[model samples]
Target: MHVFLTTERLGLRSFTDADTDDLFALDNDPDVMRFINGGRPTSREAIREQTLPRLLRDCPCLRTRSYWAAEEKATGTFLGWFEFRPLDDHSPAVVELGYRLNKAAWGKGFATEGSRALISKGFTDLAVERVTANTMTVNAGSRRVMEKAGLSFLRKFTGDWPEAIAGSEHGEVEYELTRADWQQRR
Candidate 1:
């Protein structure tokens, strides 16, 4: 059976090709994509050709990754998706956590709540050593979510970003928390 993680009001379940509309809606909001793509919409072709396949079967970048949809438990509304995966090219213990929620779900603590759960699972269930998240330097909201979820600021650096967003020039900030750090905080 397929399993999912549940929060007080949300269910995080694996995403499939059927979620195309929901995914499209989530990424279509210009406000949501401001820091990521400068308010541009993502093409459905990209989602189908690259995003879905990577989140589902192909793990060319990282192995054993799972992409889950955040469904409102009460209404079964598709809020967005959260990703739990390893970040390393060769090592799988260095897990990473990320989320992209609809505008309706923003400012509701859903991001922080979901991220905390992913971090816990990465550390306890998956026995992962590190869990991290990143965002554009200007994305204060995202940085706050990672901090609220107990990740510490790692660093800021520039890389060959595929699509240059409005704030990409400010660099990307990495926030991370190790299993040991989580344990200590607990």
Candidate 2:
């Protein structure tokens, strides 16, 4: 397995077929999927078919790639996963930073911690110029995570949301950190 980066608390490595159970468990949590699918659980088939395949493909995938399971370095427990990849069809230097951890892992700083590492990597290692993340406007927790990770508010744009949850009408908010902005933050 290709290990991409590791921080004091997380080891961000490549996903493998062996991560089936880990990924499944993460997506199975109701709260984990709340914003993603109106709390509807994700099917194993969906992870296997739709999500995993896209991540496991070769790099420069429209200028995106998946890192590894965010394992707690001390325990080797898979808290979740983090990614830095391009929003498909978008130009280079534009990447998305995302994370999905189980409910059990919430409020423990994993999201912000792992994400900060990815942002640094995006600017320094991947040579990415800008990184963005989005969440429902009401997802304060997620928004706070983005903020703590050093991203600044970029915009609030409406979209044809699939599930149209409570906050969907408020539109989705995009937070971004450019290489220059990231440098300033650092």
Candidate 3:
């Protein structure tokens, strides 16, 4: 497996075709998908056709895949994935940071750990000026992770979600960290 970055506990690596089973299990968990799709279960076909394709796509600006399959460094268990994708194909100035871990990995510090690592790399090596993330305003767990990772609340707005979920009425929130802000924190 091609490794991208490693946190104290997470090994973020490039996704492989062989990860279909792991991806399937992670997406099938109701709690895990609650914020993402209102607990809808994803089919294996969708994992292969849509999810994997998107994760495997290369970011022209970074010359590497934007999404990374996150796993436990010691056990090598497939936890979920992390995204540090550039907002534009040609510019590394702004990237969106995201994470979707399995239910089993929830409540741990993995999300914040991986996020901080990615942010540090973006500011120091990836020429990224800003890092941003978004989630339903009611997703308190995810919001806490973002704050812990040093991103501040940027905005709250209604999203054009194709399917409205439970908390869609509350709208969505955006959190961001700029390179200068990150440097100051360090």
> In TM-score terms, which candidate is top?
3
The lDDT of model 2 is 0.81
User: Cα deviation of 33 in candidate 3 (Å)?
Assistant: 0.8
Worst 10 residues of 2 by lDDT: 59-68
The count of backbone overlaps in candidate 2 is: 2
Name the better of 2 and 3 by lDDT.
3
32 in model 2: Cα distance from truth in Å?
A: 0.5
Quote the lDDT for 152 in model 2.
Answer: 92
Pairs with backbone N, CA or C atoms under 3 Å apart (clashes), candidate 1: none
Which number leads on lDDT?
A: 3
TM per model?
Answer: 0.91, 0.91, 0.98
Question: Model 1: how large is the Cα RMSD against the reference?
Answer: 2.2
**Model 1 regions more than 4 Å off:** 58-64
lDDT per residue for candidate 3 within 135-172, as digits (tens), equals 99999999999999999999999999899999999999
Worst 10 residues of 1 by lDDT: 57-66
- Give per-residue CA lDDT, model 2, range 1-186, as digits (tens): 666788987888878888888888878887887878777777899889987887576565444355457888889888888877776544457888889887767999999999998888778877678899999898899999999999999999997875577667788899988999778756
* Clashing pairs counted in every model: 0, 2, 0
